[model samples]
Target: MTSTLGFAILAVLARGDRTGYDLATAMRRPIGYFWTAGHSQIHAELQKLRSADLVGFESEHGPGPQGRKVYHLTDAGMRALRDWVTEPPRERPERDELVLKTYASWLAEPDLIREMFADQLAAHEARLAEYEHHEASFDEPPAFGDPRFGNYATLRCGLSYERHRADWCRWMLAQLGRSGERPIGR
Candidate 1:
C-alpha cells in the first residue's frame, strides 16, 4: 500500500467519521511535518480507498454544508493497517542535499562549511525549543515524565535525534577552532 493509503486508513480508524478536509487537518497536526501529504493527494487516496472497498462514506444530515461526505474505515481497512504495521519496512535510501553540498564545498571553502555547521546548530536548537513547547502544550505530552503517555517512544526518538545534531555541531565547531582557521562568519 502507498503511504497515502496507509495514512488514510489510520486517520479514519483514529476518528470514526471525518470529512476529507477533516482528515487533512488531522494529518497536519501530528504527522504533517513528517509525512507531508497535500489535500489533493488525500482526496485522491480516499477515492481509491473507497473503490477498493477499504473505506466507506456517508452523507451528513442536518448539516450547514449540504451533502458533506464523512469517511470511516471498513473492516478491510483495519486489517490492511494491521498487516502493514506487522510487515518489515524496506531500507530507506539516504539523499541529503545539504550534507552533500557541505562536503562538496568543504575542500575549496572550509570557512563556508564551518558557517554552514554553525547555521545548522542554530536551526537544531530552534527545533528543540519548538519540540519542548509542543511537549508542554500538546494534549498528549512526550513520555519524558508521564507514564501514561502513549507517544513517548516516538517523542524520545525525536529528542535523541535533536541531541545528536546539537552534539555533532559542537564537535564540528571545536574542530574549526583547533585548525586555527579564522572563525566562521568572522
Candidate 2:
C-alpha cells in the first residue's frame, strides 16, 4: 500500500524535480498544514519510492554525505497517484486537540478558557496573514486551469480555515464575556 508520504512526495515532484532538501522545505508550507513529517521520514520514504521504481533521482554535489539527489516522479508514480485519487478513501480517526479540549472545557476555569480562545484567535489571524501573503505571490492568469492554480486554491482553503477559526474564537470570547476590545458576533 502506498503511504501518505509516498503520495505527498509524488505530489511535490509533480510540480518539478527537487532535491530531498527542497522537498522537505516545500512540505513546510501547504503540506505541513495537513500532515507532519520530519526530514528522516521523508528520506526513508524517498528510498522506498526509489526501490519501487516510483521515483528516480540524479545525484548532484551538496552538503550531505551522499551528496544531493534531485527526485522526479516516474510514470509509475504518476499512475499510482492517479489510481489512488480515483479510489474511495478509507475513513480515518481525527485527533484535533482543540476539539478535544472544547469537549471537556466545562471542567476548566472560565478565565483560562477565554485566554485560550484569545491565543487561538491571534494564531489564526497570523496564519491568515501568511496565507494572504502567499496568495499575493501568485502570477497572473491564476485561474482554475492555470499552472499556479493549485497553489492559489490551497491558499484560499487555508485562508478560509483561519478566518473561520478566528471567527469561532471571537464568538467563544463573546460568549464568555471576555471579548475585551475585540468586536464579536459580526
Off by over 4 Å in 1: 4-12, 61-66, 137-150, 180-186
Q: Give the TM-score of candidate 1.
A: 0.73
lDDT of 2 by residue, 1-186 (tens): 779888888888988999988999999987776667899999999999999999999888787576778999999999998788668877889887987997777767778888898999999999888888877786653777663676666777788888999998888888878434443232
In TM-score terms, candidate 2 sits at 0.85
Runs of candidate 2 with Cα error greater than 4 angstroms are: 63-66, 139-141, 178-186
lDDT of 1 at 16: 61
lDDT of 1 by residue, 50-121 (tens): 887778888886367567888898888777776776678768888877667756644546677778889999
lDDT of each: 0.69, 0.83
RMSD of each: 4.9, 4.9
Clash totals for all candidate models: 0, 0
